[model samples]
Target: MYEFFRDLDRRWIFLMMFLCVAVPIIIIGATGKTFPEEPTQLVRAVFDEIENLPSGSKVLLSYDYDPASEGELAPMATMFAYHCAAKGHKMYFMALWPVGPQMVDDTIENIIKKDFKDLKYGEDYVNLGYKSGYEGVIKVIITDFTELYSTDTRGTPWSAIPMCHDVNSVQDMDLIVNVSAGYAGTKEWVQYAVTPYPKLRMVAGCTGVQAPLLYPYIPQQLHGLLGAIKGAAEYEALVIEAYGDKMARKDAGDNPLTDDNGDYLIPGKYTEGIRRMGPQLVAHLLMILLIIVGNVIYFVERRREGRR
Candidate 1:
């Protein structure tokens, strides 16, 4: 039995990990209980800022993710949009990645339009689409938004978009909410937008791998951060608690799951980060147990040889 267990193929371990992830996901989907997540200061700060904002405040959402991080970053993006819309904040949506515009469009379709349908385009919110210059665009926008994105996704001049008509520069925004994956993301936004302007408030959400790297800038250049899916889940919980109940009373018989807090349980949206944690925790335990057993086997063999 020892030898059989010792010779167990790695594929067996992989199967076990798969089951650990797959099973919980199935159960969670049926029952909305995601492993209890406690929102850290960073998560709470992000939610608090939006909640405290005066209605119709100008908020810029920089979608710096591509299809690669869409799974992790998209949830927060949707949540940020919902939070801003819920506050009646005028949203100025734009993206740094070429595909980012599509992501913004998808979130609007899924979370915004489905719920905040009454928000008139060019008034309550405007999608500035995407631009190509990376950090260079940020440098330009820090001074002027129109010179870079002269027109909206619909090709109407910036002047035509009532929500954005008065906003001439990034400084005009009440907050810069940056959702990023890798390069040309929060780092770039911090370097070009938030860093120079002492008053340019910013909050961001990045994948777990990128979180550590951005730590030094937090609570300074970045007012707050949402780290990976866990961060998203944490922030989502905060949103649900603060806004979900309020929305429930007003939305009257409306499906809370569709646009309200229920959007946090978004199918496949929260999967990557939340689902990943289960396997990661199991894999870590398996590796630790393997190490301890290996050490025992080595010491036992050494003692047996000495006895002989």
Candidate 2:
């Protein structure tokens, strides 16, 4: 038995892992069921910070990412936009990377434009677009916004936008929310913006590799963080649970899952992070089982040697 187990083919292990991942994903898609997730203090802090803010609070959202990382960070961006809009916060959008502007625009189109059509541009929300200064932009904006941005993304003068009138500098913002991918992102914002203006509160979401580097700043220089997809997934569960209940109550007679037009109302995009979590959970369990089996085989072989 030990010889057969020890000589198990690598191909069999690979096949098992493949099934372990694929089967759960297929089941989740068909049934629309996901593993339950409890929000950690890290994620809860982020939610509470936003939730506690007064309605109509000024929020600056910096999109320092590009399309390549959209898969991991998009869900987080959507939740941030949705939550802010739902909370009646005035959202000011901007970016550091040149491609960052497009990411900001995508969030507006997908989340704000689609679901919250009542939100007027330049009033409830405005996009300042991409500025070329990188971290230098953060430093300047910390003190003066109009110095770099005299106009919103559309080329309209800042004076023309009602919201811009109130935002002379980054300090005027009630909160700084950033969803970043790489260099000139969270680190730059931390060093240039938040560090100097200790009174300014901030929260952020970043790719997995960047989380550890940013963790040291949490609950102090940085108020809260969504570390990666897992953190995003946990946050998603909390937001959906709250929002879903509110929607259901409003549509008391009709299906909460669908709009008045009989079309599906709940955007599937909102659930991306949570949906992906199902397969990840199964894959991790399979890995742990494989490790246990491997260790058992090693011990059995050692016992055989001792008998000899």
Candidate 3:
């Protein structure tokens, strides 16, 4: 019996883990059992900032992630675009990483292109694609965007972009959102964009590994943060609750859905982040149980040795 359990193939454990995650994902996909997320203070702050803002506010969305974080960060970023688009805000898109451009493009393709087709190019929003300089780009963009990106991604001059005309730098915006993955992301935005320009309100959605380091800056420097898939889930809940109504207004051009008005009916691709949380919660629970069982086994063996 000891060997039966103790010498279990490593593949079995792996299979268990795979099923633990896979089952929840499939269940959620079919049943759509999303755990209710009560917005934390940080998440509330992010939601409220957008809520309180008047329509047509200028929002700078800086994509600071690569492919590595597209799973966790992409959903939040897409929702960020969705929320801003729903609110009728002008989104100025830019990226810091080389691959960041692709992430930015994903949002444009998925959210802006499909949902917000009414939004015009170079007028309602602009995409200033990735720049090589890390913090240097931030330093320059704090004062003048034209210094770094003289032309938009299409090789059009900044002056040609209706949204880019009066937009001098990060300071010109009402609020800034830096969706980051690593070193050149939210930290750089906070330091160069928010630190010097105190008036600039900034929020971030970063990867799980990097979330703890950013806690120190919370509420003060960063207005809100979406930390990993959990953060994305929370933000996803917020957006769904608040703006899910818009899907009901879908006209002939909209994506086909069974019940566009009902919850989970529209089925925006942003749900990926929230869906991941189901597996994460179950996996963490399994780990906790395993740890307790391990401790029990250790303590039992220790007592038996003492008797010998």
Q: Which prediction has the highest TM-score against the true structure?
A: 3
The alpha-carbon lDDT assigned to residue 93 of candidate 2 equals 95
- Candidate 2 TM-score to native: 0.84
- Number of the top candidate by lDDT? 2
What is the lDDT of every predicted structure here? 0.81, 0.86, 0.83
lDDT of 1 by residue, 1-308 (tens): 66655576888777866776677667656764455567898899999888888998999998989888887788788789888988999888899888999988998887678778899888888899999899999999899987889999999998877777688899999999999998899999999988899799999999889999999998889889999877887887777767755444233464444544445334444234454455445556767877787777778778889999
Query: What tens-digit string does per-residue lDDT give for candidate 3 at 1-308?
Result: 54445455778778878888899989998886677777787877887787678999999999988887788788889888999989999999999898887888888998889878899988888889988889999999899888899998889998888888788888899999889899899898888888888888988899999989898888788899888888888888888877765743455886434453345464648677778889998888877876786676677778889999
**Model 2 lDDT tens row, 1-308:** 65766898999888988988789878978976777779999898888888889999999999899999898898899899888998999999999989988899899998889878899999999999998979999988899998899899899999999988877899999999999899889988889988988999999999999999999898788899997789899888878776764333235565466556553344567888888887778878988988998999989878989999
Models, CA RMSD each: 4.2, 4.1, 2.5
Which residue runs does candidate 1 get wrong by more than 4 Å? 1-8, 246-308
Per-residue error (Å), model 2, residue 91: 0.5
Candidate 2: where are CA atoms >4 Å away? Answer: 1-22, 246-266, 286-308
The parts of candidate 3 lying over 4 Å away from their true place are: 1-9, 248-264, 304-308
lDDT of 3 at 308: 100
Residue pairs in steric clash, candidate 2? none
lDDT of 2: 0.86
Instruction: Give per-residue lDDT, candidate 2, residue 243.
Output: 78
